[model samples]
Target chain A: MTAIQISVFLENKSGRLAEVTHALAKGGINIRALSLAETIDYGVLRLIVDKPKEAKTALAEAGFTVTETEVIAVAMPDRPGGLAGIVDLVTRHGLNIEYLYAFVGQRGENAVVIFRVDNAEEAITALQEGGAHVLSAAELSAI
Target chain B: MHETTPCWNREMEFMEEGHLRPLQSERLRDVVARVYERVPYYKEKLDAAGVSPEDIRGIEDIVRLPFTSKDDLRDTYPFGLFAVPMEQVVRVHASSGTTGRPTVVGYTRRDVQMWAEVMARTFAAGGTHIGDVVQNSYGYGLFTGGLGAHYGAELIGASVVPTSGGQTKRQVQILQDFGSTVLCCTPSYALVIGETGREMGVDFAGLPLRVGFFGAEPWSQSMRQEIEASLHVDALDIYGLSEMIGPGVSFECLEKGGLHINEDHFFPEVINPKTGDPVPDGELGELVFTSLTKEALPVLRYRSRDLTRIVTEPCGCGRSLRRMERVTGRTDEMLIVRGVNVFPSQVEEVLMRIEETTPNYLLVLDRKPRGMDEMEVQVEVSERTFSDEMSKLETLSERIGGEIEETLGLRVSVRLVEPRSLERSTGKAKRVMDRRDLGR
Candidate 1:
């Protein structure tokens, strides 16, 4: 299964993050993984959500600037190197990982790992062509 | 030999009576010619009026030159008014950009000395002397009030506590522990300090403060009286503009009649803001200044939008240079709310008169759902008024609304907010908020 990543820009101010989070919650979108990068004026709220398309639509309708990027979601053993195996494969394929985080589905049988790479499309193509089980949005939503 | 007592005020007050007038007159003529020769803006303006720099022979010939207004300063931007090279300028300060872009002004080392001297004289007028511990609450950096007061206190050999504005309770503690004798800040800040001191049960009456130099905004005599009674000190108003020089341009002595214009450094004239003609004594007009001794950025008849009457009457303080009444209102500060001309000073005056309300207030101009303009005056009620019955609160609000309607010729909704509901300004309080069409 792959990790669905979404990007949102937020102005820096008190309670601004709360406003966005509350808006997304009202839309019934659950965030699996999140990372926030910021500068003086604004921050980019990166999220791996259960429903990427619906979450992007909800946030855009709520007046937030959102961007989506394809990220490699490699299933791990839920133990050590569970994810390092994928890192080793990507490194062997001459790919660089920009950022990565992990999330576990409700089933608890598998670990869903998220990856931000310098070239996301190539990483996804290579991982999929390499016969890795890259989960689609439908499979993730069902999980 | 003992050190001589620096008569910082002498150059501004008594210099014309001695040899400073001739020196100023000669420099004034030379400066006019130099500006005509070097600065294109001054040259074009003066030339268009068919006036020659050679025509200006003395101080009396100043009327021939055109008046310089804030618009001129704005048009010039950072260095439009500089007569000398930029490298010679020792420091620069600017007016707050509330209306538009801020007007920039510069000074040389000698100009800074004059500023310090002006402030020294102002401090001395309020009875400041050696060993007196002065606490300065004016906001520092880029703004002239704090540094100006600091230099004056330093020049007078007074022990100064450089506690810039804010931290109200700590300010009271410093007043108690440090035994600060003289306080320098805006009149509004002094009132806030008094209110805060009362809340903390500090014996404000037991404080060592004997005098307060309050200015940088228009404050009424009623306010002065209230501040004096609360803080247990005599209140003196100091007046100056950044375009002319900072706080040391003029100050009120013990006389309390008006602010004495420091004629040695600044020459003040009251001219009609619209007509540019001199107004008679006691008539309210815009203040115009000519920096007789300012070296780096000398302005000739620069119009300060501040509206006040100039008084040449002999003051008991013995400084004969002229006095200007406390500013009534500035031309730029007049607010046209819902077709009624309203000045924030009038609202402040009304609030001060009401014993139940706190001096802090905000004028909120909002719009209705129907797109019609409406105004709300959110005045803070004192703690004593807070526990009053609902009926009493309603009556108080009605009374304030009626007075505002009467004074401003416009109806307004008055809301009596809780005590300390309105935010306290560490520097100048922005009293008006125009939210109409703001989002658009």
Candidate 2:
């Protein structure tokens, strides 16, 4: 029900993104899903990886300021209006989404979307009650 | 046991005004004639002004002589202004010049001794004594702060710990272990050391640090209070310029009233920056200095561009030397936004008063598309205050912007950056970034 997301504070300089990826590659860490939010001076690199503790230590050792956050993964119908339906349901339930990203599930029949909400537990309960499938941490990690 | 008076050289520091005036006149005449006879640059400038060495009869005629500016120094790059021959010149120092050619200064053996004497006076004014542990943290090499303080401490017979800026953690350790009685560096660097020391759980109040001499950059009174309270030391301000000499031109005595200028060796004048006329005493004006005893590189009425006023009123320290108020801003560094003048020091005062932010900030100036000047102050917040909550962040920004507007009388946009985002400098922090040219 709760997946750990690793976020990094990156200065918006040339080759910084490459440096992060290279550090992870050398550490044998694979990024499952990622999103980057940037401003003129700096950016935050949000990443979903297979190993949270290992990735955090490696990134920290590589001189990156890393933060571990809890996020919920929701499974949506692999159709035209899948994301739209989930968004409408969340909007109706009065849940706020800070940010989200989607990736195809291992089965290819459903799309798993990672949602970073203000309240992860409440968001998961509301989404489950709205008849959406929420993936557990172990299930997501296995995928 | 130290037997020297609180004033380094009792004879010179307490010299009566009558004696000082005649000494200045004699030294002024000798220096003017020396420059005119040896340096071709000064000879041409003096000839063009229709004045000669003989025309400079006394200190009163200093105004009649031509004024020298930094541009003139740049024009005569390496040795054009050295009055003494290369064989006679013993040492050389320079400004970083980050922008263009560095202004080079040469010193003969006597010139070096004169520098050391003024610095010694500065130390004594701050109540430094022989056998005291002096921690010199100002950067060394081409910059004068390091060597200037080093030589002065040695001349005063103080044990010199030439720590020379950086290694903040170690600086704190040494302050505790060495029992340093005096600290020397820029005020901002001192703050950095204080913050680092606190982070390392060093007990500054338990340390034996008695006095600190901070200079090489403009700082506000609020910053002084912060440094004094945090570092557990009496913070004193010292002023100088590489153009004339460094770190010993004037200093604050224990009275902490105003910096007593070493007028016997360097004559100071406050003048209207625009019209170049001497201002009445106690009126704010640009500072100008004429080196009366310098031999290697003598400046005649060199415009320091620092905005301050000279206080002829005698100080409580019993020294007859005239004191100049702490410089508020540089005439060249002042920014005009929407027809209102502002100095970075003013912004610094406002920012330091706010508890949520650190003193690290940058004033960015740009010309808007509507053809009006705009200013944006990018300030750094403490790690605890920086949050992902947009509302809270917005509120902090608005509060800072309002305070700046209330203090400086100008509306400015405030950007609260994360901790350590603004560039930090080991010496003379860069506080302003003029991006108006990018708009063009």
Candidate 3:
């Protein structure tokens, strides 16, 4: 129904993203997906990792400002119109998606998509009712 | 006065030590009695010290009097320490204080006259005279510097150009077009204008700008040489605080060695900063002053906190008043940037208002290439305020910069460093990194 996401504060400078990767590498955690949103002053490194709690600790101990939030992760058929179908279903359900990122993993011909929506419970209910395989925190980690 | 010496008040400037001591003693005793009788703050301080006006028979009994610190001024606030009634006070000036409030000083008509007289000496000590066009560049409004030098220049029958501060190119143009013979501003600002004139292809050596009075912040002897060469004029140092009637406290004469204190009005003493006891002549200690002739806001044995030595030797200028070595440093952590007082705690106060910022901060201070003060405050981003958004962080930095400017009256660029990026030592963390070389 919901997945854990780790967010880190990064100054918009060289080696900042490298530092985040370095921290995760040192902590022996795998970053499943990440989206970098930036401005002139600083950036926010949104990370979906195999172990969110450990990644947060590693980044925090490495002198990074880190936060943990809940997100919606779903799997769809790996086809041309798969993303369009799921997005249209959510839009028809009147659910707002704040941001979304995707990772290509062929788990029986399906792609994983992580979403940050306004209401995670409602988004999960609507997606499940629409026959979408909504992934849980455990299922996202297992992937 | 001797023909070799040029002084504003011939009688007082050349008065022998024997005559000046008694005059100071009489004035000190009178002011002590008047403050005790009129000001409640002084009355409480004197009574708490178990000393009264009768105990202060002359200048010799000044030690028995309690010392007034800036904290005492803060406690009394805006006008609680004024000795005279508001009806008799003619002017007021203020300087930024450590706390949110500013230190205010009020002056009576006669007190204003005394400030002008001492400032006149400050001008004449450097050989400025009538018919000289004095370009007064000190800030004019609430600060005493601009108006203090203005009144003195006019009192000496000299034409004044109240240029105030800023606009370096315009200042250079005025120096060229107005034919100003005397210059007044901070040492750093003088360097700024000198460099601007050079860049604008204005030759300073060809101009008639003879001398400049620089103060409001400390500069090194090397800086004096730099300014003299750049501006092509004899640069002298003028010292004062708003509480002491601004810029005429003590001044460097043509000798350009130590500054001569106008002891007739302000009595100067050097004391061990920790013990508050008087330091011997020629030994460095904190400089303290007692206002002898001031009426509106008379202060006795006010701790100045400036570190310098007292030299009682007769100067080649033939002035008998004791001179102080140029101030070496301060006993406190106050930073004087572009003639304004900036405290690290002041910045901390501003940063604390924003919940996202931690209490730990570092202030990096430097001088621009053209010679204006610049600062950057490095603050750590907190975990609670972290978000998956960039505009929120940008807004945080801008809000910090705005609040700091409003509080300290200084334009400081805010730098949001990463958490744990700023050093945390086992002992006291160093909060300030002063990069400007004032020969320190």
Give TM per candidate: 0.59, 0.64, 0.59
For candidate 2, give the lDDT of residue B145.
93
- Give fnat for candidates 1, 2 and onward, in order: 0.00, 0.00, 0.73
RMSD of each candidate relative to the true structure: 21.4, 8.7, 18.8
Better of 1 and 3 by DockQ: 3
Q: Indicate the residue-level lDDT of B1 in model 1.
A: 14
Q: Candidate 1, clashing residue pairs?
A: A1-A135
Worst 10 residues of 2 chain B by lDDT: B383-392
Ranking of all candidate structures by their lDDT, best first:
3, 2, 1
Off by over 4 Å in 1: A1-143, B1-24, B333-440
lDDT per residue (tens digit) for residues B329-388 in model 3: 576867788876676766765765788987678999998888888898989888777656
Give the per-residue lDDT of model 2 (tens digit) for B262-334.
Answer: 9988899999787799999987778999998888899999999898899878777788889998886788877
Kindly report, for each predicted structure in the order presented, the TM-score of its chain A compared with the true chain A: 0.82, 0.94, 0.95
lDDT tens string, model 2, A45-129? 8888888888988887886766787888888988899998877767677888888889886788988888888777777777888
User: Per-residue lDDT for A1-143 in model 3, tens only?
Assistant: 68889988787789888988998999999988889887665777888888998998998888788899788889988899999888887878788777888887746587988888777778888889899999889988988
TM-score of 3: 0.59
- lDDT (Cα, tens digit) per residue for candidate 1, span B94-131: 88888899989898888888899889999988789999
Candidate 1's residue-wise lDDT over A24-121, tens digit each? 89889887777776545345577877788889889877766566766667766677766777777677789877667777877787887777777767
